[model samples]
Target: MRDDVRRLLASYEPARQQPDPPLPPAGVLLLLHDRPGGPHVIFQKRTDRVRDHKGQISFPGGVMDPGDPDVRYTALRETHEEIGVRPDDVDVLGELDQMVTVSNFLVTPFVGWLDRYPYEWRFSSEEVAYLLEVPLSHLRDPRNLVPDRRIINGREYVFQAYRFGDDLIWGATARMLGNFLDLLSALE
Candidate 1:
């Protein structure tokens, strides 16, 4: 499966979009680790102290800094800052298509692989509330895809999301996850 992921990513051409006026660039790491049952993906529950996406479940990442060389670097840097995984520690598989967030940021999702489990994780309490290590099998189950409805300014919005216990993965993150899962499904 790991080899399949690497090969698939190597040949994949991610779709790109250039919106008018341009949105600020952000990067996120879809960190995957090999676990007992199967593979597990890492997600961080954001603290309410953060400015954007507060109390939301997301991959470890943030906006690109001026000094960062590239979007990939931004993802790695943010991952290291949010969690303790160093850039060198991750075997970066590749990237998925760019996603535009409701917060007006162009986010690039980079997939990375870790060799083992029970990794020494040091997370930022100021930004991260907790970490969730979700198994791929659970995520792949169609039953987990739950419909979410919200009302904003007298308008009803329906969204497709994944439900893991008390957490709801939706919006751009869910879209990105859906894309990643589609690729994995293609391999099977």
Candidate 2:
């Protein structure tokens, strides 16, 4: 499975990101299940009680813990700690390129596979209020992802928007997801 995913991503064009100055922190992307039609990625809505990225839909991860040996460890550990998904249940396919968040964190996205749908999630109430599943196929639709334009000092730029059900998954997570979808589309 890892070999197949590697081949898929390898055959596709990679995402283009600018060289970052310095990293503020790190993050994770937990790619859970891939059924017949397409895969599914998990998202957690950060509760307002959290100090950072509160009330936003994000992956089940946070800043690298001091005891973490690396970002990979941080991802798995945080996923388990935040959402009760054990690292043992995850088969890490590989990693997407590191992405720099607007908040200045250097987010390293780890791609992995989750075996089954029937499992339990223990949410960190202070951090996660709820969990949601996004069909990977949804991200492939260009129309589904709208662009928001902004101009500062007579310069213009655009950010991608992902409308999923009633939830708007945007910001760094959307960018990462967009990049991942672009890769999958290229494979197709």
Candidate 3:
């Protein structure tokens, strides 16, 4: 499965979007680990203290620093800072489509594979509320997709979201997940 994923991503050309007056670039790591039950993806529930996307469920990542070489480096650096996963430890598979967030960030999502379980995670207490490890099976289930309605700036909008237990994944993160799941479906 891992080999298949790697091959698929290698040949995949992710879609890129360019908006007028470009948004600041950010990167997120979508980490996959093979556990006892099967493969699982890691997510962090952000604390309310975060400047943007406060109290939201997201992949481990952040805006790119000036010194960062590329968006990929930014993703690895943020993943290490946020989840204690060393950049060298991750087998980076490939990238997914770039997404523009409501917060005005051009987010590049990278898919990485982890070989081990029971990882010793040291997360930033101020940024992360808790870590959520969700099974791929649960996320891939069509029944888990729920309709989410929200009122932003006095306008109502409905979005598709994933509900894993009590945690709701929507917004940019959900869109990224949907893209990845679509790729996985193509492989089958």
Candidate 4:
């Protein structure tokens, strides 16, 4: 099962070439676990002080550092730093499709499984504003799932959504989640 999950997430990152304009590096985690109901994932709200995506609900990840070994290492390390979960605690299954954000960042999403829930979490007041351990069932709810259309640089774009409470998980985060659901649906 763990190996399977890893494979699914890994499918998201394709080895592609960006000729003239190279993409900025970023990464995130798509964590999952089968509980009494079904699978679940985690989310966090960025602090208003953060330079980008402030006060918006997001995954616990960030831009890759030069010191990181690879993109996978970047995702694992960022999640641990933001959520206070050590890298060993998360068994990375695979990765999700890479996404291009409006901010021009090319983010790599990784999937992980955690059986033992961590007791406590600490956040950087400068980066994380709120935390949510959202269940996969809740995200799968059609009511919360909505469509979002936009015109970026005169090009029309459509994205999916997962609204949790007052926060709207749309844009890159939501698109990534939507991709996850699409993959899970295929397995069913």
Rank ordering of all candidates by lDDT, starting from the highest: 3, 1, 4, 2
Residues 42-151, candidate 4: write the lDDT tens digits: 88889878889878888888888989888888888888888777788888777677877877888988878875754367777678876887877788778988777879
Q: Candidate 2 lDDT, tens digit per residue, 61-128? A: 77887778898888888888888888889887667767777666778887778867667778788788
lDDT of each: 0.93, 0.76, 0.94, 0.78
Which candidate do you rate higher for lDDT, 2 or 4?
4
Q: C-alpha displacement of 127 in model 3, angstroms?
A: 0.5
Candidate 2 Cα misplacement greater than 4 A, ranges = 1-3, 9-21, 35-37, 149-157
In model 3, the Cα lDDT at residue 12 comes to 94
Superposed by TM-score, candidate 1 places the C-alpha of residue 110 at a distance from the truth, in angstroms, of: 0.6
Which pairs of residues have clashing backbones in candidate 4? 6-93, 6-94, 9-95, 10-94, 10-95, 12-96, 12-97, 40-136
Query: Alpha carbon lDDT of residue 81, candidate 3?
Result: 95
**Model 2, position 35: C-alpha lDDT score:** 62
Model 3 C-alpha lDDT per residue in residues 1-188, reported as the tens digit of each score: 77888988999999998988999999999999999889999999999998989999999999999999999999999999998999988999999999999999999999999868889999999899999999999999999999999999999999989999999999999999999999999788
